[model samples]
Target: MFKAVGKYVRAVWYLMTFRIDKASESLRMNPGVVSANYDRIIEEKRGRINQYKDAIAAMIAQEQQKKDKLKEVTAEIEKLEKLKAGAAAKARQVAAKYSGDPTATRNDPEYQKCQTAFSDFSSTLAEKQARATELEADLEGLVENINRHKLQIQTQMRELEKLGEEKHDAVATILSAHEEKQIADLMTGLSQDQTSEELRELRELRQKAAAGARVSRELAGLDTKQAEAEFLEFATNSQANDEFDSLIGLTNNSPETNNDGPESTRIPES
Candidate 1:
């Protein structure tokens, strides 16, 4: 009778464990549970990604504005530098012309002209120097801001990386193989979309920057030509032979004129 009772107890214990194992397996493989958990994880990751994307976009916009302003300031600074150089050159030429004449007095028309030109050049140089200083300070501030933005971007990227890792961990822990694969594919698709958008924006920015640079270069070229022409005209009117020759030399050595030689003058190699 005791043996029979022992057998009955062992049977009851085995049956309970079998049911428990079956229930655990059911829980693990349940489609509803897996789907719900997968969705939740994906949603959370997407939310974080969207937040990061928005932040990055705002930063990029701000950086672009700063870049544009920097470009403008740089171009202005370049123009001011050229103007200052021209003024100095003019002052030197005037001084040299007057210096060659020992009989020239302060009251002489040429002497008076030299003094006036020197005074104007000095004043203009001082003004431009001050403006250039201000622009340099502004450029430094913009650089700092750009650096800050870069740091912010780095932080955002790190956060995104961490979030990605967390997403993978969450998926691995809660999802079945099929569900994990689906979520992975979805994430890949979303990532591709984001990458494409970023590429498009970068391309657009590059094109705009290139266009702006081209326009700036063209304007600079025109200004340079105008300044050169004006200087040459002043030299001619003043009968400053040496300065006129120097200006002519500069014109002759210009890339445009130098490259305009006859295309048919090629020597054939024997």
Candidate 2:
């Protein structure tokens, strides 16, 4: 019993699914529905593309930031190098003051101050240079990524445009197919369309109406009256023809001149 119940439920589910699918298919095939669906899809794609563009914009912004940072780092490195060179120049002048006294040059407070300054500058410059190198690499990567994304966006835009064209073509093709199907159905005499049925009913009604009119005419003795009129017209035309024949000498006597009968001949003397 449980197995049977399960089977029954399964069958019902399958039937429902089938019906839903069939209905969906029919709805999708409608021209207006098809167009609306395409529009919806296009809108969705456009929204997604906009989101993608936003992301690309962010990357471009990041790329610019990296470039700015790299420029700043390079400038700082140049300044540090200049400061280090200045420190070395100051140390040389101090050492020249001690002409031949090497120990005095090493112990000189001014020379020692210049050496310390140069060492600090050298360390700072090296650090800045390393940072500049890192920024350059990051900027290069960002540029490459930005360029690739731009290409992708261009391709997507083209695809979007093509989708627009496809929408029209799809609608046209479906409309044409519908028209052809209707014609084929009509030709095959298998069309069960409501409009076709209505047209047939209208024609039937028209024929019945004509037949009723004929019946009504017969019932009202109008047909007899028409026959009587025709007979009268025939008699009038025959009389007119006789008169014309007599005037043209085609008949021996006109009804108006020989109403009595044949005329008698007169006899002479002898």
Candidate 3:
């Protein structure tokens, strides 16, 4: 029931349905319906495309800042750990020096004093080392999290770029069945003038699709010059059509046909 057109189509379905006959006639003769549809699709695609790009940029800027701070925290943890190890080694050296003194009592003021101080220092150093290890682990985890976020952002951006207009058009292919019927009815009852208009719309759509395809290809950085060449070809064709149409209008009020000769051309005759 709801799997044919799109939001835009859904919103305007009534009008389209009401004028179905007229629209159909216009479409058959000019194909302007195709052009209008293309315009809607392209507009939708461009909006989504920009949003995706902005999301990637925002994620990079915001999340990368947090990751940089985590790096600094890791470095600080390492430095503190080295200091703790040095304190432990120095305390052991003093204990060893006093151990060799046979005349010294284990309970003597000096030995006991040194022993008390060293034990306290050792405990403090151990605590610092433990804290540093925990901090290091947390920092490493943070880095991994940031990397995963970065990868996700990049993947989405690439997919969006790749999918482009095709994906967007596909998204909108869910209009009500009634909408299809309405459009069909319109197409069947269209007048010659209306049909010509529809045909014209279709021709314009073909040209835009051709150009948009080129732009998409250029974004992918692949075979771009070919797209440029094709666009140039279409532009030249359209200009020629304009001139031919003017001549036909002056010579005979009737519309000119097949100026481009091949069915491939979009603009009217000449």
lDDT of each: 0.67, 0.92, 0.63
**Candidate 1 structure quality by residue, lDDT tens digits, 89-185:** 6645655767755555444665566556656656765665576567567657766765776687577667657765665665566556656666677
For candidate 1, what is the total of clashing residue pairs? 0
C-alpha RMSD by candidate, in order: 50.9, 4.9, 29.1
Clashes of each: 0, 0, 34
Better of 1 and 2 by TM-score: 2
Error of 3 at 206 (Å): 43
Q: How accurate locally is residue 216 in candidate 3, as Cα lDDT from 0 to 100?
A: 87
Could you arrange the candidates by lDDT from highest to lowest? 2, 1, 3
| Structural similarity to truth (TM-score) of each candidate | 0.33, 0.83, 0.34
* After superposition, candidate 2 runs with Cα above 4 Å error: 234-270
Q: Which lDDT value does model 1 have at 143?
A: 64
What does candidate 2's lDDT look like per residue over 4-82, in tens digits? 9999999999999999999999999999999999999999999999999999999999988888888899899989999
Report the candidate with higher lDDT, 2 versus 3.
Answer: 2
Candidate number with the higher lDDT (1 or 2): 2
